[model samples]
Target: MALSQLEVTGAEVYATQVGDRLTQRGHQVFYVSDTLSCPHKGQHFRLLFNKRSLPRRVWHVLYLIYLILRYKIQLVHAHSRASGWSSYVACKLTNTPMVTSVHGRQPVHRSRKKFHALGYHAVAVCENIAQQIIRDLGVPREQVSVVRNGVDSQQFSPLPAANNDKPIIQIIGRLTGPKGELVYQLLKQCIDLNTNKVQVVSGSHVDKRFAEFEDKVEFCGYSDNIRSTIAQADLIIGAGRVAMEALLCKKPVFAVGEAKALGYISLDNLPAALASNFGDVADDGKTELDIDYSNLAEQLASFGEQHQLSEQLVAAIKAEYDLDAVCQKLLETYQSAYVYTKQQEVPIIMYHRVTQDDSQKGAYGTYVTLERLEEHFQTIKRMGLSPITFSELAEIGLEHRFNHGKRYIILTFDDGYQDNFDLLLPLLKKYQFKAVIYAVTGTDHNRWDVEHPTKPDQRFELMSHQTMREIDQSGYVEIGGHTLNHPKLAELSEAEQQQEIEQNKAELESLLGRELTTFAYPYGNHNQQTKQLAKQAGYTFTVATDSGPIGMHQDLQQIRRIVMFPSTTKFGLWRKIKGNYTYKKASKQARQIDE
Candidate 1:
């Protein structure tokens, strides 16, 4: 389900693109808005009401509840505050997940701060908006994701410009609010109407002040094909999505938005422009306008001659704003929201080595005795908790599996020790439980740890290729990747990290004759870059220690896990599973204090 209050806006375009893509991906989509201006290939429902009316607000909530129940909507994505408040109520009543996209800076008020209506998750179109909501609206930082407005690169690709004596400067925006006033100011004060071919592409009526330059300015109203309109211009004047779309079309943009003016987008000012969402926001987070029309006009004229966008800049924009990548991120957000709504936690138990004797114990205490392992397995069985692999969890979404009301836990053994194949596989088979073994494919020994100067020489043999293949073919165990040499991922350069992560996954998949879906960070140490490398390496789920920033199931790339130490008893295991999130929070806070 998609909800929007505006007829045609950047938020509506985002909804349309996401809805159409989701439809193509074999999912049914529904749109509820005041106007059916969205061209999404989905069922549209009318939601017309005065936002300030008390009775109408109640009616809107009830109507949304009816739509949700009638369509069995799995999720509701609200695009604006008017839709967000009522949808929040409807989703809560219907026990459905909701995601709210914050497109612009929100007004700060005591009432809004008290009831943010951010739903389970809030997506901001830029980092500036994300921070604003967290700081001003009292939305939790963890619940907010920065997902920019995606553009269909193929549809908005570059077009060859036609030569003309005078450059056509097309200004694109809704002719209302600050944008309309900006247009009026530009025409009256900044733009040279006689020297430049000026055109205004807006859906609203032109300001009467523009009557002085009637023949000089052309009005191209509400174009259905914005790309065609964009292609006809020699230069573009807009902000936010308009600036982004023009850049994608390889046209120079004079970045002027609702709040401020970034005279022209160039490599030098691109970072600041992007941070403020191409001038839609200001440095101080105020709504008052900040553009000097005379200075802006002078800069705009000189900018056209000074700036020629490089190929790298265009490629960077395409990659960052790619439609498919944005949709994937949104889908992940949806999944997180759905999981959050379920209010159930899956405890992922992490193990490293299995030992039979006290002599084999290492200083790190990362191993458990074989007998104690079997005892833990017995406790799991006694608790009637089904052990599942990460691959299985990926195949069956968290919501679908948890909806059955059956208890599920994940048992993961990291650094595929030969003892696992020699001893652990039999225990898994005996209990009929599933487990994942993350193997470091490059070496067959614990060289990374053994070679350390200060660490104990706790040398252990890793599983061989044949051993891994046999166990992977067994129904009880799934094989995963744990980097090549088990280096601290945060310490490695990006190229080295990619080589370690991707090469490990590729080798394991080749050896197992199937794709590997899980990865365990070596030493449970990683950073943002390393996490991205893991994702690029094709791992569906990556494991980290309890120190991960987000909740366990919130971030698939860096899932938190329960470390099963050698001293962990049956009671300890039970306590950890029963209160996994509580334990994780305390542990994280404790670690912070220790640090």
Candidate 2:
């Protein structure tokens, strides 16, 4: 995906590690952490161990023991047998359960014999591997578990693919770790087999972790339009995240994750991620590896079945891992941790601008008089609901604090005009309510040819929004990146897209001396690339202008917002909020009903 800027949605996966899942299981989970890292990527990690100068492997063991003793760890979930042995011994001494997931690899793992002695339970990504755990590894049937990796079907899906003969093979993954290792080998095989005619596009990180792979392959390190790439693919060969994406596109996918065979796992064994599997090309007798090039070329010939296969695969993939089902399972896991966790009832009401005068008017926002501001404050004093800040909303989003029954609302204004301070500040002071103004911070607002000047500016403030360049620290405001160049991010290249998202963060941090926590999509449009870039850029939430009022339950990204027009009435506001305005209607009419 070519995502130049990020969007807000549950689109990005952050360091919500094992214990968090266990907490979802409704178990009494204890979280211990002393350090935190950036939140933009799929996995969020803390310093489970950090030794400044020590080789990471050596210190990793020492830190493991330290954490086990410090926290009195009750269970250990390891991805490899070597890690399992370490966990098993510590858990045995601690009388803890060592439930480990294979996470698909074998190169550096300890022997199955050693793993057996560790009293560890094995979890595999697919059933075939679960059987292997029971049969090949001698783990008991009950001790092995299978959980097919899931995809957000709503986020990634195939387009009506084109019947083009220039076959493109799409592969997305990190340049290092299992993903990098897999790509390294697979690309080499393609190279040696002399299949240069097939276009290969790969997406992943090329940071210090996977930098070595740069020399061996033409890497498309990051993207916003991941779905587009998949749609272009004649076939997709990947592991982990990319494989799941391919299935979403309903493309024929080939995957490998088992380190035992260079992570060469089969797509058929995967969840109904594809309409049908394009089985691996078996090697001819003359080739060293067990795959054939001629057969692969013949297999690639099936690229013409684009839409036909996409339609077929959609049902299969949806049946396996739709969001509703996945969220339900995750809900069970969360409920297990705390059986009483209920639907959070704190309704998040949003407001745009507030004016001290009742009659001063603007389009799409409320204008309150000083009397109305005081009346609202008096109501807060009498107390049925409380006002919360943007940061607090973020904590709720991260699930750090759950709102029990408190009625609450958040104030946000778009277009960061000077009137925010002029008209709203006095009223805000009167009520003592905290309001967040989402500033445009760019010339978009001030760039009036001395023409059509009064059209957009309302009583507001301004912040840095110049395509996310260096932040200006005029402490009166909080700054964030909208993008270096605010093109719809899904339209950029992988490298250019990554630069658009990351460079702004760097620029802003350098200017503001703090990391930016908020982002608003330039025009409220984003794709897979934008979501990933936002994650990589470490935004807590990305706001959109096109959506409806953001409910508390909405994913942090994909957060909805409703803008009232100057022509709106209160009755219509409530109705729009109730979600009565249909998306289908909005799509057809090319309009969103304000009411």
Residue 525 in model 2: shift from native, Å? 59
lDDT of 1 by residue, 153-198 (tens): 9988887764767878899988788888888888888888877899
Worst ten-residue run, lDDT, model 2?
Answer: 1-10
Off by over 4 Å in 1: 1-6, 22-28, 92-96, 127-145, 205-214, 297-307, 339-341, 345-388, 392-471, 474-476, 480-595
Provide the global lDDT of candidate 1 against the true structure.
0.82
lDDT of 2 by residue, 1-595 (tens): 0000122111122112333333453433432222322123222224332223446535544555676677544345454444454455555655544555554422222565444742444545555455555555566886565544455576676655546555556655555544455455565544332332333453334545334445544556455566766676666665455555676776656554323121222333333222111121111111123345445444445444433443545566666655545444433333222211121223333344455554655443444444544554465545445555556566554333332334554445554545556555556566556555554433444332123345553433343344223212322234546665455666778777678677766765675567777666655767767777787778877666555322323355555555554444445444443322433333444543443
Q: What is the C-alpha RMSD of each candidate to the true structure, in Å?
A: 6.4, 19.7
Q: Please give the range of 10 consecutive residues that has the lowest summed lDDT in model 1.
A: 397-406
Candidate 1: lDDT of 411?
95
What TM-score, computed on C-alpha atoms, does each candidate reach?
0.72, 0.40
